[model samples]
Target chain A: MKIRTLALATAAGVALATALPVAASAQDAIYVPLFTYRTGAFAGSGIPIANGMSDYLNMLNERDGGIGGVKLLIEECETGYDTKKGVECYEQVKGKNPVITSPYSTGITLQLIPKAAVDKIPMLSMAYGLSASADGNIFPWIFNPPATYWDGASVFIKHVADKEGGLDKLKGKKIGLIHLDAPFGKEPITLLEKLAKDYGFELKLYPVAAAEMQNQSALWLGVRRDRPDWIYLQGWGAMNPTAVKEAAKVNFPMEKLVGVWWAGGDDDARAGADQAKGYKSLSFHAAGAEFPVIKDIQKFVVEKGKSQVDKAKVGENLYNRGVYNSMLIAEAIRNAQKITGKKAVTGEDVRRGMESLEISEARLKELGMEGFAAPVKISCSDHNGHHKVYVASWDGQKWTKGSDWMEPMKDKVRPLLEEAAKDYADKNAGWPKRTEACDKAS
Target chain B: MDILYKIFIDPFMQMGAAPDLLVQALWEGLVGGVLYALIALGFVLIFKASGVFNFAQGIMMVFAALTLVGLYEWMARHGVPAPAAIALVLTIGVMYVLAVSIEKFVLRPLVNQPDIILFMATFGLTFVLVGLGELIFGGEPKQMITEQLWLPKGSIDMKILGGLVSLQKIDIAAAVIASAMVAGLAVFFQSTRIGRALRAVADDHQAALSVGISLNQIWVIVWFTAGIVALATGIMWGARSDVSFALEIIALKALPVLILGGFTSIPGAIVGGLIIGVGEKLGEFYWGPLLGGGIESWLAYFIALAFLLFRPQGLFGEKIIERI
Candidate 1:
């Protein structure tokens, strides 16, 4: 009976394996493999992001007949944000000739960075990657556009400084950074400490363990004890809601607790309802579905039942961030095709395309994304383009623009970036020198 | 000298300087400890009954909570009243079905298997439940039906120790409910016939089987009991924060609680949880900064290890027959 069962199982496995590729090859399109986390601790944040990417790409196929007359075929591989599964997904998808890989995880991005150099596939870690990856000289194929963590740290400081009257007013002020204990959470620490030291503000850190995202009473107790003037949260997923709830629980001034762009989901602030009214989060893209591009997405993708996203979630902060991320992917593909003069370009071509992206205000207008996203321009020498961010405050109903586009303290940030980039290159030994890409103009 | 002063003298001085904050920390610790105890109670119930280290208990908590919330949401969307939705989900025998399915497929097939194999079987069960739960629930964090469930919202601000201590009413509700459940469990385990059979089977499976105690029936009852504990835990925890699978990681804290409690003792689980939670809170709050902060993750394990070194059988664990 065992032998008979084994024979049947083996036959079935072989049959299924052989049938999958045959089905996949039938779709002649530019395959974009999305390493998405639709389920996990981080799924609350990831679901809308993944939906935006899928819906936008699906919209391109539905509305514009795909970018450059070629259909955009996205094969989503669920990562659940686990590094091991993310790596598995990368390996599984890389062989399928994907134009570019957007690793949503920092740990996964770290693994894929060295591999991206070897595989010659252009990787986009948009808004979140190694702060030093912005130095495109040592890292050629890797890209983290719009902003880096160091930029975010500086931006947070700028806002704090603004709130405190001036930079000199930041002196003797205590700033608490309540963060998740992970690579992504730790990205802002080195920069924040440097800023604190320079600005003469006392910096206190309360790191939440990944396992204890939901259970953070002690962390809040520390937050209460320290009683910093400002609390900056570097948390994601269920952590955000819990942190907000805990803040509300402890009577921490909701307006003073600022979150990074990743922490600014509509659902996050809603966790504390009326109390979370004055809560604020950093945002690069404008929130809400008023943009023409969003309406196009709604009419083309979500409304037609072509996309898995709900009609109500078409223009949420994270959803819009997802839409913006997908917009970047689409623009990169268009740029790659424009540069290579091929309808469907290779990963190498996409690398060059990413290095020389000219996403000006006018181009955004042309793409129906003028007010939706910040105008970013990427060059080989500087991968982090146009580091402008706006603060959005929740008013118990919706997130409104609380601040104008505030550029980071570049003079304070650049020297640190250069040093970190040099240090990274020194550690890696024989890191790739940007000889050709840096010389070219978009 | 300064470092030593900062590490040892500073924390105590700080504690003395602000007695109100200290009281606040202790209250937070007590709340945290209760939640931990609830999770560990589920583990203790299963371990005491079946010796099959159920690794899927965390995911089970998530699944049960997700089901309740998902059903409630679905019902609300369909214009059904919250109580009717609550009644339908609560009365649907979800826990019974889960217990029976687990016993039949997971336990019955692997009966008399090595203890490690049964433990590994639970890991398989974890994966299955995680996939199945995610498939059903769609992975977005859901706010617990606090109002519909009649759970209190907002907090009570008490002025003492020269400052205010804010305690959530829901946390008070949780403490009351958890204590009641623990008390109820003690009675069920002590006097009930099925509970006696469960204890006998827990003593020795073969010996109990020879004495006409059906292992299958006992397994279902125990698992069903664990499921109920999980539900109670889920409601409390989900009320505290949004419900998501990420909350499962908090369940791992129960491991140390179980280790300290000796897995087989109900009261031990509670005591162990309180100790670990309080200890973790105090350590993280006071000594955390000196050690670069975030010591709450390992403090519980270290505490358990220190205790285990003195009492390897755990605080209330029975001595092994072999050791005897």
Candidate 2:
């Protein structure tokens, strides 16, 4: 009798705790649930990024009194970079009727893609996710703005092209792709392979198993033998630092090696110290906490001791990237409020706002993030704004800008994107078609 | 004909073409084997005394390393000289506390339990340690203080078989220290009084108990000893890569070593680890391309599986001379 009573009470308690967030939704607030990861294997990079997202939102509340008088309600559900936990967080927060869900993991973003359409929630995976999700027509509810992996891949090739003096010089150039043997790492392979064939370069592939990330002597040995002229690193977490260290050990030219944005972390390069100097990585936004918006965050959120961020490390690369991500979301919310003339907008309204987003230089100045990121303009058919990506080299101290904005091989990547998106839509069996809403938003 | 040649002859041709690469592969395998052997040694020590599989050994390694680094860094920040001493002491002290708590909270209550239950208990213990370690040390990967610990750094290049092979000085140090630890442990086990008692417990817990051996005491000692081994393994491996929970996954590589080297035999663990390590690297280097270049993920298990099919008892496992 006592056991039965205890069981009943426990179940009731769980139900109430689960339902509390759903019931506590405020009519005066725009709820944006951030499916953030502050722990687990990739927490080295995840913590700063998540803090940036949280701090920027908190900054708006303190500095601007929220977007258009409706206080922003940012809820973070820790995913620990796990897909199952990400989905669970999504289900738990979906009932709260969030304006958006920015799942920072590619795996979580992929899982939430179909659910976003069904749940009518816009899933924002900034710069990482299935590159095919960039086709806004099929994945109307999904948004990966600024650039996609395919776009990044093309941009890398173009940067290489400019460095080598001409595109034709890539002929017979041996380029090695050292990637994590996972879906996220494999995202750029198809585009890279096609480019290799077109450019007449020999593409040697090296896939690092997750467990073998730190123990990559064999792979680097192969790199030595193959002697790829350029190495494109597509790695994350412990893999990034280990790869940089291994490259250093093998006397691989750090300047000739470039990493994707995910691999270009301050901690990653710092792991190798002076040896990692001259290591290059792609960046969609300028790094560091020197922007005016960051000062506002320091003055308000961080200085007030409201945020979990270490105040000293506020202006780091991943943290700045996080600030850039929140800027995108906040601007979209403001856009949504203006479009619908509703301060407390729903997920669908925010989706529209994202579609109509045109982050111009004037708006950036107004936001106090003048050069944080490129001007991101989204449309109905194209989800990723596909902005120019620049190279940032870690010169032992900090990441310094290496190049002017290099345009992606859009002439090459766009056709592939359309075909892949179609393939994805067809493969999924009756993917949702773009409604008249898309035409109106554009 | 193309497929046959690619499978059978091509790898050998490549090996001939780059004998230096083969030597490099062998050296890498040898180093990895040593690390795996160290982790396997922890398993053997606990299993030999208590008959518990102890799935928490991997997490134990992470916790040990984290405690060492965390305290070391904290002390260094506070102007402590030779922080490595403080780090080592704190790590061992934490391990002792862990062993005591584990024995008191987990092992004691479940004493005389079935082996499977003890295995399951270790699984629970894995989660407990992971949560505790993360709570204490946050989940950031920290660089091992090689200079503080006086472990070697940088690399040395030597020409072998018409190619250059560069080895990190740290790895050479790891190999030397691991071999020394193994040799020292062998001497202790063979000669020590407590070692005799531990062996008696391994043979029969009931008999050992009847003969006046304190089961609880032996367990604590074995666990503490394993803790020291874990700390050593953590430092060595962390010197190669950053110390993080991710090392826990690499620790799983010790399982096949356990399989190949029998569960109870100390010598078996060392031999088995080397074999699996060498086998996996060779397979990944030569045959990996045929299987999408990631046979390292499963090749160790596959090698162990095939070996088990025929040997049943591992390479160094003793055949019972006469069944009671």
Candidate 3:
């Protein structure tokens, strides 16, 4: 009787041990902390991105039962587009073990990068962040998935060259850059300067004061006086349409004006669509209704009456692009879960997953977004995996692809990137050391 | 000589070259000026009736706009039709009841205090309104209830001397509404009993008190009317851009407008608004190059400053002879 009792006790202990893993797995939720600005000057962009992020998470739960059966939980903290507030939010939410954070503002991303390494959290900046973060080995915690500003500048210059027949034909031509007087606007300058030197073109710089972009008489006067052959706008908010309108006021050819991706949106065109006809902008992904992903969003999100925006805004350029951004982040999280057998993934796990991600053609096609973006293959050396970009032009109503995907001139950009990164590191003093491989390359 | 050219000759030359652009700039300035006047009108109404410069007028604009949008959104969420949803939004009129209570409880006891103290109290009220508005409405910029309100859209494009001068349909509506409101206010002050009481209070508080007019009652009526004016300005301006805290800054623009148009004169506010509007627009268009553009920001203030140098009492402000 004593032997039988001891054997039953051992079996009960085994049963308890087996149930522990199940309980642990059951409580596992992939927490994604969102730093958003729902109130501020830039809320127009921030609101949509926040809604898209939340809606996609909801879609994951409803459609696929979350990533690998571990439900995704998102906690939002409003940043009001302020960097200091963003840091505070980061500190507050970092304890939750967020897999990754996407602070949509470049200013916020810059502030959070140091904290990212300290907290062991990954920051996934799809497009807006430090350009030098393209060297993922140096910035292991930061991941710029698709492209960088350097890549954007090169693509823009290439488009201009192609328009003028060839790169050699760019010599003796003047390309003016009208940018906001902020870090966000200054991103492409070093790259463009290098490109101008290599391609033998004159580069003119025009800076617009922040919050005062609506008024641009002096800038246009400069435009009229200088007569630059091409205008590249690195502007945001009201600056885009204001520039277009001012250009029209000065009788400058609208076809010659180009803007960065930030300026390419429905609202930007809405104000001065007729005058802004033929205004080209650099885009990393497909713009307009051609993408199947857009159709699916309109069907699944808008048609089902689950959208945060009006049905009319569903297929709009910026709104749909926001949806694509949500899908990308979701895909990265899923990929991370698959690699790490743990049902609950941590920030470090997400970082590894982001570096090793390969969004191939088949995956895109399955997700109904085939040909919308180039196949992104991120690695330790390259954080901005796909440096492919196309030029889209506004034809009064909608955006149309004006050129095929073009690669930036890396030969011109690499040295500049290294210099800027070294300068930044020297100033900061406590920045993480770059790997020997990057050092050797530099 | 170059400085003289930059200050005067160059600006005129540019204006001559870009007459069309100048006209467009003037049009934008005029619209901005009118909005500023609307905000100033709210301030003047309360100041006239209660002798208190309500600093909370800006937040009132934001609060009214937010309430309108929040109510509409809530109605939509409940599957209410657009027309009924709008009617539901009009129920934000209930805020006036709260306003009246605050006057009775908060301000009535502190009556006869110095104007500066009263101003500080209103400043406190500003913060309270901001906090309460954000707490209730979630501190986000919501689309204005323009469609439900049935406001006009697009602009009327006119050609003048080979130049296109486009004015928004809503701007015209704003001008008309503002004119009618001012006219109604003038007639009220000249014709109505309560309006005369308000004017008497503005003229002399103690003397008006001796005439058996209940100052508290006059204050309530004035505050409510000011709230209505704020709501009107909020809707008009919100329809233009959006309903958010950013609209609050629109009220600050009225400070310069108040300075240019005498604080006491209603017609001065209107004419001053138009002058500042037209002047700043033309200044930005023609003279902006000399100052690196964006002159509209400082143009009105500088104009007011220069005008004050010439006419210290403002365009129609009564001169007060100091005994000191």
Candidate 4:
């Protein structure tokens, strides 16, 4: 009889924990689920972003007493950069009424795309995801806020054209692409091929095997042989620096080399700084000690001893960018609450808010993130609100802006986005029909 | 005739046009070869003494480096300065004690088992270490305490032929330390009494036992020595990149080295590592474009496979005489 009583009590406790929260009205609290990889091969990049995401949530709580007086609760589940683990984390956390998920990985985002539609939860991949998800009409659930890989590539090529003084100047030049052999690295291929056809530039492709980033002797040797006028590097982790070192060995001028944002970070620069002088790359967010968001982070998170990782890496580029990622989510939640008059909004409500987000300059200034990113306005037709990107060059020590913001050729990109998204929808049946909020009226 | 000239002769002619580039490629290949040799040496030591391939060697390299960083962090958390943190890291060598205990408890009884069984057991051990490592020390990559360890940063550029050849200070240090360690290991095995016992046991375990040499003592000593080599390699490689699981795959490069060098010969490992390293570098330079580059991935394995056709027993391994 005593044993029966203990078992009954344990069941009652679990029931109470689940039932007690739903009893409260929508204004009680706002819970956001965070999926991150704080351990494994990619932890060098993951830890900083996870820390920044958590700190921004904490800042919202401390500064504003919560969004609309509803406290923010964040649950962090470790994925270790494994796609299977990331899916498991999503399933475990979806029950908590998480309005949106920022997976911070392209591979994880790809796995969760089908689930996002089934669960009616918005998956906000700020920078990396299915590049085709930029077409909101097809991938209504997956939102890439600033830009996709295609946008990044086109913006980079535009910078090249401007540098050569005109698009015609690029007619006969050779351009080489050295990329990691993964979905993440293959993202810009279609757009690059299109650009190659239109601009009449010779395109050479080089593939780097996964986890073999540190030994890129052959890729650089090709650079020596073909001697491409410009080299585009799509790499991650140690591959970035290894490529830089090999290029140095082949006497490939760093100024002519361009890396994607993932390849252009403090870790990559630190590895081959002296040898990689004058290397240029794309930048979506601002870097260095100059940004106000960085200063606030140093004062609030680092000073209070609540740093997510080492205090020394508090203001690093990736860490601050992570903070920006979290801020974007938190603001979207606020916007949703304002429109719905429900402090604790549902996943559907958050999706609507994500569709209508307008991160204006004034909002950035208020959040102490001025100049970190341009105004990002999302709509149903375009999930990637910020198509603008700038080119930045590494000057041995730090990154400096090398060119003004350039936009991708939407006329060339939009058709490809639709085709890719349609193919994805065909493969996974039962995707929700997109709301025609931003479509041109017939 | 024209195709042959373009394929072989013209490239050599171009080498005259760009002798500096050829020399630079060779130098980079040499540095890569040295690091591979260091990893291969660690494998040879463990296999020679115990007759069990320690598949956990790579993770152990990562673990040892992580422990040093963890100790340094722990010291700093308690208000210790940088120099004191260095002293604290040295004390972190107790991980080897725990490692030796694991060998005694987990592996000692499994002795005399089939080689495949022993290999499977080591695979299980690798998983346990990977899990325990993450549990004890969080999974984030930590900067190797280079300043504390007094390793220099940056590289020295030298003009060779017509091109500029550059070598990192850390790579040079790694090459020098690896040579010294291998030399010391050779002397220890050849000149010391315990080393002779180790050799005797490696030759014939039952005979060594009959002659009064304790197999347990030799196994313990060899594992302990391997632990030291792992620690040294861990620090040097971690300083080059950050200490993380990504470095574990670099340890697998030693497998091809083992295949080429013979699993049982120390000298074979050194020579095999150098050959694979230099060959991959040269293949990447001259032949990579034909396949779109990034040939370093499978080049080492192919080289070892081709070499096996001629020297199936490995360069330095004793030929086995099997009775039909």
Error of 2 at B248 (Å): 0.8
Name the lDDT of candidate 2. Answer: 0.87
What candidate 1 gets wrong by more than 4 Å, as runs, is A1-28, A439-441, B84-92
Maximum-DockQ candidate? 1
When only the first chain is scored, the TM-scores of the models are 0.94, 0.95, 0.88, 0.92
| Clashing residue pairs for model 2 | A289-A315
DockQ winner between candidates 2 and 3:
2
What is the DockQ score of candidate 2, to 2 decimals?
A: 0.63
- CAPRI-wise, candidate 1 is medium
Best by TM-score: 2
Q: Please, what is the whole-model Cα lDDT of each candidate in the order they appear?
A: 0.86, 0.87, 0.75, 0.78
DockQ of 4: 0.43
Off by over 4 Å in 2: A1-21, A439-442, B318-324
Runs in model 4 lying further than 4 Å from the true structure: A1-28, A244-252, A273-277, A288-302, A395-398, A426-442, B1-23, B66-101, B108-173, B203-210, B307-324
lDDT, candidate 4, B45-131, per-residue tens: 878877778898888788778778777777878887774357434734555674577578766778777777877877887787788
Rank order (by TM-score, best first): 2, 1, 4, 3
Best by lDDT: 2
